[model samples]
Target: MKILVTDPEGYVGSLVVACFTQQGHEVISVSQANAGAALSLIQLAVTDLQNFDAVIHTGEICGTQALHPQIAGNLHYRDAMHLANLAKAAGVSRFIYLSSCSVYGAGEEEYVTEESPVRPQTPSATCKAAIESDLLTIASAEFSPTILRPAIAFGASPRIRFDVVLNNMAGLAWTANKINIPGKGLSWCPVVHVLDICQIINCILQAPRPLVHQQIFNVGDTNHNYQLIEIAAMVAEVFQVENFSFGHHGFGDRGLFMTFDKIHQFFPDFQCGWNPRQGAEQLLNFFTLTDSIQSHFTLTRSPYHRSENHLFHTVSIA
Candidate 1:
């Protein structure tokens, strides 16, 4: 199957490109290759601020870990949306948007299904939600548009986000010895291995159009959604650090268990085969590199800083 993957050098995009390319899919990188190739663009144009005072103030006021929303990369973000139309123009079989579960809002509730409403509080999520709405509209019987709401993704990529649950806990365990769980560690945090995400996209590419042609799948089975504490314990086991400990932690990016039963209604064997322990172990192996933003665990380069005023660098997946 032929696939056009945007941000091919990005964390999720790179992982997807590696996975599909390994699987023999004809792949194209719209972000890296040609600016004219952007399917749909995003607006992350705000440059990273240089003032340390501003970072501290924003952190204090906004309570976000990153310096700010990824505004510098907005144009590319916007172009990715056009990717769907480009895919159709290219006669591509499927257009997959690497969306996030953040659109579903933080933490779990009685009901968290695909049919649930999306409240995108943060800029990143807001852009994702908006683009998703645009994508669903251009889709139809002929053009297969699938939006995958993946749980917190962690795996080998250029931009590995240590901010996510499992990776964060693993980073803590690897460095601080105790995994920190905010607020009783009871809230559910749905997770999927980075490679598993690639597998889901590959499935969409391989499956008949009806299974995913214009459908949205919550890219994991019910077994994948786990509580924070449970996830931390698994990471502890991965490090062979018996009795690893953490307390209730707090963050604006809350998470919850998600029901992937709908996707399972089609593929029963769709479970993410990688156990949390194993996943944690894979990440923990890079303990020394965890602290530096250049850590080997990271999948995407931090666009927040640069050696020059130059803001954007392109990677072509032609």
Candidate 2:
């Protein structure tokens, strides 16, 4: 299959490109700059969009940039809609949108499902929810948009990110010999490996059109829902760190816990390949092989670092 993937240089997007290419699929990558360009420029830049079998949009403003409504609106919502419209215009049948599970914000329910009402708290989540709604509205017999709301992605990638929860804690534990848990570490979050996210996309692209058309699937293992403290402890154990502390106050973002039953029900063969411990171990190995130090763990050193603080943030790439 010929696939056009946006933000192929990003963390998840890079992995998606690699995964599809390895699977013998022809993958054309578009950077964020080109994707967000003027419509006329985009049309000229990416010619023959109709020839592609699918357009997987993984480009957006994430992390702190997503905190601002204007930035998130222009990049996440407006620009994304532009690309989707272009793909639709070009007769692209399968449009896979990478959304976040953070859309189910601040829920008290034990497990939020696809049917659960979206209560987006942050601008990022709000934009994601809005985009999902608009994409579904634009769905037609010729165009099928499948939304995958993946949990906070962790694990290793060619474009590694130390800003996420598991990665940050692992880096801290390795370099500083301590894992710092912001707030009381009580907030719940679901996490999935980067590789698993790519796998889920592959499954959706391979599945029958009717099975995924206009569907929103929460992408992660149902059993992977965990508390911040639990994640800290896991990192501490994996890195053999003796010191880990929690803050006195809570982070403003609401926790998200989701059920993956809908995805499994539709694609029974799919399963998350990596758990938190395994992801941590993979990071540990990465840090070891690279001889990563304290400076390497800092935000200033890595372009992939998104958060000012290394603790877990509600915002993440799918």
Candidate 3:
């Protein structure tokens, strides 16, 4: 199988490219550098798109920084729509969109399923929900669009992100010997390992067309939901840090507890191999092996901050 992956240098995108290439699939990738101009070229290069069997779009303004409406609209919604159109134009049948469980957004439900109403709170989540809706609307007999709403992704990647909750706590525990829980640490969040997300993409690509076509799947283990305080404790245990504290202020009420039953029932072969404990352990090992110091842990370089033309190569891993 041949695949075209966007934002191959991104946290999940990098892993997705490596996973597919390792599985003997031919993978062609495009970075998010100069998205507008690059996508304009891509439009002209429609013939090139025909060479791929599927498109895995992970190229978007991710993380909390995507709260900016203009940035989110252009990078997340516009770019995605353009890519989908190009893919469809090139006769690409399978378009797997990397949406977010954040689209469920601070719901009152105990467990939001794929069917649950999307109440996007942030601009980032709103763009995601909008993209999902538009992509579904464009679905056809020839074009099958599958949406994977992954939970807050953790675990290490070649393009590691420390902005996320679990990873941030792990870094703090390792460097400062303390994990700080903001606002009483009461908000709930679902997390999945970076590797698990890659695996889920592979499973979807391999599954029968009927099973995934126009389907929305929340990607995370049902058991992996944890309160912010619980996550802090888990990180503390893994890093062997004794000091962890909570803030006196109130954290935002936004929390999402997602059910993975739809994905599990649809693709029985899919399994979540890493939980918070294992993920923390992996991060600890990664930090130790890399000799990561306080500086490395403290510097938060989000993709949104990168130069528009900044490009990265696919990380080759064994």
Top candidate when judged by TM-score against the true structure: 2
Q: Model 3, range 1-318, lDDT digits (tens) per residue?
A: 999888876888888888899999988877666342234323436787986789999847454243567675656676788889888999999999998877877767877998899988767677888999999999999899999999888998988877677887776676567776766688778899999999889899998887899999988888998888888888888888888676543345446677899889988878999999999999989877666454477675433222221121110000
Candidate 3, residue 294: the lDDT equals 41
- Which structure is stronger by lDDT: 1 or 3? 3
Q: lDDT for every model?
A: 0.58, 0.79, 0.78
Worst 10 residues of 3 by lDDT: 309-318
Q: What tens-digit string does per-residue lDDT give for candidate 2 at 78-112?
A: 76788888888888899999988878877668778
Error of 3 at 117 (Å): 0.9
Q: Model 2: how far is 90 from its true place, Å?
A: 0.8
Q: Which pairs of residues collide in model 3?
A: 34-308
Model 3 CA deviation exceeding 4 Å by range: 34-44, 63-68, 248-254, 292-318
Estimate the TM-score for candidate 3: 0.86
**CA RMSD per model (angstroms):** 11.0, 4.5, 6.8
Error of 3 at 186 (Å): 2.3
